[model samples]
Target: MGQSTTPVLDRVGFAMLSIIMISVLVTASSVFGTSSNPKGVSIPLQERGSPLAKDGVIIPEALARLAYWDAAKQHAKINNSGPPNNSSSLFRRHSAPLESKLDDILWVGEIEIGKPRQRFRVDFDTGSSDTWVFSSTCVAPICSSKNKYIASESSTSTLQVGEFKKDYFDGTEVSGPIYADTITVAGLSAEGQWFSPIDQVNNMEDYGRDGLMGLSFMSISQLKAPTFIGTLLSQKKISKHIFSMRLSSGSGSELFIGGINPSKYRGELTYVPLESQTMWIVKGSASANGRNGFNGNMVIDSGTWV
Candidate 1:
């Protein structure tokens, strides 16, 4: 069956779904329903076992055991396969945890870069169009607090001649040198990926994330590089060009890199043509409290709080 646009219900209002660089963020509070294939890879956006698991936050024992079992199976498969062959063939852990303190607004996930894999905690933002991390050269107080990427240490990293500088809407600016490297997320790898290792940051000293992975379009990218989603599609790492995000108040949040998780939502998905491809901005109208009011362009920002 062909793909379709769908929407899901959650704590927030109706959030429509889309494909390609665009994503639909929804949370289901009802019975599950089946979604079409091209159901790409799913990356859990939060840790499975929460620290508050002992404080009335219950994680089913069966689920916990199943996760461990799946990891073991993947490990055994890797051991038998002998040496990684391709980007997609790399060993995949069952759950890619996005570490976030309970009730924290900042949702962060882990991604591995380089040949041997240098892991870094990154804030997946849809508001921006470039991926950047702290460079080994950055010795400032803020950069010192995060995991710095040493490009020279990675055999697969290729130095690209260019500078990457971006000014975010929040008044923070990041500047660094551009490089092409291998970036792996949720066991799916995008090779020869373009990104920046920032040596300077302004007005972002308190930012706890090691980096920010932009899921926006390439049209606005400063690096003139494809967004991570775009590269994945080009490499055929993910069969579909679409991705979905299910952000929850707890550890249940997830980022589906290819397609929608059928079991996550119900009802038909309503499609909304974007105002522009640069960002996931759409024109829409809504009524609240029996008052039919409110219409304009709404930017679906995953990195920000309501």
Candidate 2:
């Protein structure tokens, strides 16, 4: 299907279901308090277990409902939206298997870089365009706690000129120099991939992951470098220049790098033409509870926490 200029409810609105809830978890530490400890562990999506089970036994119905209700309250409070009317049923339908003990989980995946493959857990964000990682050059306390990418250890790594700096709306920042190296994710590999090796960070005490892997376009990249996903498409590593995601509260989520899994969702998938190549901005109208609230452009940013 071709991308649509007008936003469809199923396409834009429903696509944000999981992200909205997850963003609350992401912003809690950064926006409301100090501390960068992420609540859940980062693991490959394929390895996750059921969210409703404990020791092979289904959790009590009452307990499960209570947990869902609590999560809904948190989601509504953080987003400043109305309380969920029927959160129990909503959770029952969407809740899947999860491997974490947290009430909600932020999806992260593993990727390999360099010749020997230094592994890193990254948040695959669609809001921005820049694949950056913590570097050995960093002496900051935050960088010291997470995995740092070392260029000298990689035979294929090459230094690049100039620095890369990204500032978030909430005051978080990462700055470092650029480098080219081989990066592999979800079985697809891109050679000579340009990325930033972070040297310093500010107001980033709550970020729990090693770095971010941008899934958006190159236009908005801090370095304006070709994106890893774009390289995969250009090299024909993936059949189409597209990907899909499935996120759930306290459940296992999936990210399709180059395609969609029809079984992951119900009904026909809707496509929207990207308003900008920078982020996944699309033309869409928004409403509150079926009542027209606003109409304009929408950025489907998985990385944005507010």
Candidate 3:
């Protein structure tokens, strides 16, 4: 959300400082109610990246970042939704590690679906409100190396009447049929969760993860169904409607579901009220390394490095 005309700081440095400062600014906000003590689920994050080039050359950070921003912007245009209601109640905690790729540009974590539990790694994106993954019907070259969800294999899988398609800024798309099944993340299960089972991938190359788990509000969801987190809240799977992510250069990153880990962060938590509910939009000013900065509405997006 904060940018500098001069190259005041690199991406990683700026990201770290922003995260910490934001945490301090929005820690005790009413969004995370003060009614009850919230338990934290700490998931460790892993580091990963796209496949090497034909000549075994890694992609440059600037180019990779550009691609990410394009995708994030495309997602932003999807829709607008209101903020979710949050209640601070006790709930069980589940923890897992996330995978970080390309100099902490991409953060992915494991999730399981179906009765028998087909596992896959997904990028938990907050910029979008749709959760989608490759399906067994997908025969695209891009999906050949990723895990595909097989509806027939899961007795709990129900075919929903609808099609799902997402267009990116680059004109590439990933789409498929919708399904409602049991989705498990970090040991917490949300039954009858509706998500797109991607069977068609057009010009959309792999991004080191099987699919994406959108953590934003459901109003932007393409399926018109509750987002995974929303489903969990409605189903009473997690009493607290709170989750947080800690990103870094590589490794040591984590996704805290259900609540925030007090151990991971110290000092009094500051709560910055949201300016808008559609996304994590907050009005705040940012500075780089004690230099001059700008003030405006900032979208706290984890889907891309802005």
Candidate 4:
């Protein structure tokens, strides 16, 4: 797989300029033939850091917006769908910053788990559907540098013997046992949420964060468990089935679950219906200015680099 760096935003025009670098997620209805290509995998890679713009031509703000739609188109092509439909009326919104790091390609956020609430830094990935973390039981070198989740300490933690494994396009792999615990994000909490505690890792350096919190649907999860967001929605923790993010060039970024923050973007919020329940697939057409544009489906993947 080839690696490229670019900034992208969500369909609703969130101003977050994600600096993505690594492999792309290939969708089922690939423009290219299907042969089990690594790019065809649904999982998104944790990207390396890059500046919002190269040279001096593209302004960061303008490029960020354009990249957002471009990323959307990429998702459409991957999923083999159409362009994103405009969403201007859904207005209930809530927001939280993408915190804990600066000048990084991937956005990191803090989430609380267990009874006493052990905090962990997580990469909120929209491409894949599984939330895996480093466990205290892990003796791997990569696990040593980050906070590990201790299942025994949580009064609500439950152990399960099911195997969990996820492979990225870059050849990074994580595998371990599954556990159900309480997870809280942005003041929203879910009880008995299923997640994996990684005991083995390969190409751990490809990911800069401690763990991955996939925001995609449960259909893609190896554990076949509802994701944190899905759990929240099912339990009525969040009212809407939508989330928004704003990644900035500063010390932190913002993530809004259940709605959009009107103060973040200026224009009308474009709405796109999800083509598939597995990932956030949107309908939209894409092209370079004056060039012939192609129409297809794209995934709004926060885990993928542009």
Candidate 5:
């Protein structure tokens, strides 16, 4: 035989996970890449006084935003803000006075969807009952206008955006739905989490995103049949009796999918039965707020007030 070549078979599935570190995630950690800089901030000046330079000067607004973005990124890297293989690497808490380790908040890495859009991370919410993105259909001037629905890629596991109706326009609550679209984050796929399903006619850009993937451990996001926690349970990823939220502000909050580190908290976590209407509201006294200030019924979230 002159030459024999065997075709090799590859078996690993390709999961394209887009991790978007929210500006809020900038609360802690310091890892990053230069590619992350905004094009406005990175634009090189041919000469100091070029017309694009605005009187031989850098744009103050751009500079300030860049500075803030940079700081947030750096904070995350320093704190090792990311998922853990085990439970040990999840958080480095800070309990002060009586216990500053009390203020440890958990952070989830979010993915920025679509180009030239307002970027936001998806939180696993259990407190709220709606899922939305900074989409075009959102008429509130405060909402991000650059958001868009992403559907060009093949989704082995992905979100499906649905019909939209306008919510507001010109400071008036008009009739437009938030709509639907697919969104994925952290290599975890929760399909149909997005909103807004209309094709572009007026302005596809008008509907910023299909919508955001709100995957709060609490019951905040609105789903018809399967709540986020309910889905997690169906997948056998967690227990029906217990699921935890370690909402991060910037430094320490994190989301625990299955269980909390026994050593991380002092007393056991007291979880209230989540009502479909309000979501999982973990209750703690004011002292818990002073210490952890996280995971409370009626007023808890992944990102902290800090």
Candidate 6:
């Protein structure tokens, strides 16, 4: 006779069913879902174990969210992955990274910058190369709302070079100029994190957010600024070949720098060759008897899902 099913196993069954179904639904190329939009976030991965595990799958949204938050709370940083704490050098300094702190996790949260201090996060996007918020001049809330706007009014150096009257995938066609601003994330600061000075649009409303931070792993600066990962890799940080990332359900998640406990990842991880400024990418090999693969350029970006 077949064994009886536990409530836990039953729940796991449901979650797997949901994810597979959603993947199928979005896989169609012609009717492909617009991932560029809000509802387009990828289906959450299994919370704890392999999606195929009988007792390991997690399908519920609540469960997935909880897992991500749990991961972030347990966050740590990348410091020379090979050894004991070595802060004596430029790259070896290790501190409990802000990635662990609540502020770094922004499913939706506030970010204050500049003298006037602009605040908003509703349309936060990780795919874009720029970071912007609304202002008084902006019809968005980052501007006139009693809330706050980055007081560009106080900065000593400012650039109004990048202006956009165009709409982004988020559906907000905001008017603003890209300028240089000192930015702070969970108390960690970037002296020249690119920012914008523009007012919020009046009609725009997100589930409600303070602002967006670009986690896409691209360099927007002419000088080629460091990426979220490269920033950690500087000088003496980390020695691990890879780190694990768990984007939990809620706004928080962890980028386990050195490594994620192996118990988490399920499928095989493909390591594309790393290109210095090109980021993470590897060349695909040719068929057994065929010619070598394309000698073309392939830049590796961790933010890329495909």
> How well does each candidate superpose onto the true structure, as a TM-score?
0.71, 0.68, 0.75, 0.68, 0.39, 0.42
Model 4 per-residue lDDT at 92: 12
Q: Which stretches of candidate 2 lie over 4 Å from their true place?
A: 1-106
What is candidate 2's lDDT per residue for 123-212, written digit by digit as tens? Answer: 777666789989998998878788889999999999988889976443367899899899998668888888998998876633357888
Q: RMSD for each model, in Å, please?
A: 15.6, 12.3, 11.8, 13.5, 18.7, 19.7
Candidate 3 structure lDDT: 0.61
- What is the overall TM-score of model 1 with all chains considered together? 0.71
Off by over 4 Å in 3: 1-37, 49-100, 288-293
Estimate, for each residue in 1-306, the C-alpha lDDT of model 3 and write its tens digit: 111122211111111223532221122111221122248566665644332221335447544545444434534443342211221111111111135343334567889999999999988777677889898888988788989899999999999898998764434578999999999998888898889989888756556778888876555667888777677766777665667666655445677777666555545555555554456655667789998587766656555433
Give per-residue CA lDDT, model 6, range 163-261, as digits (tens).
544333213444566655555433333444455545534323232333444443343322234433233223224332223334443322333333333
Best by TM-score: 3
User: Each model's C-alpha lDDT?
Assistant: 0.61, 0.58, 0.61, 0.57, 0.29, 0.32
- Per-residue error at 59 for model 3, in Å? 8.9
Give candidate 2's whole-model lDDT.
0.58
In candidate 2 the C-alpha lDDT for residue 48 amounts to 25
On residues 1-306, what C-alpha lDDT tens digit does candidate 1 reach at each position?
Answer: 111222221111224543221111223221111233446777767522222134434436533543443333233222323222323222221221245443234456889999889999887776566899899999777886778899988999998887999754334568999999999999889898999999987766354578889886676788988878778767778655566676665556677776677766667765555555666666766687999786766556565432
lDDT of 4 by residue, 30-87 (tens): 1110111111111112233433334424346534544554544454446545445632
Mark the regions of model 4 whose C-alpha exceeds 4 Å error after superposition. 1-104
Sort every candidate by lDDT, greatest first.
1, 3, 2, 4, 6, 5
Off by over 4 Å in 1: 1-38, 47-103
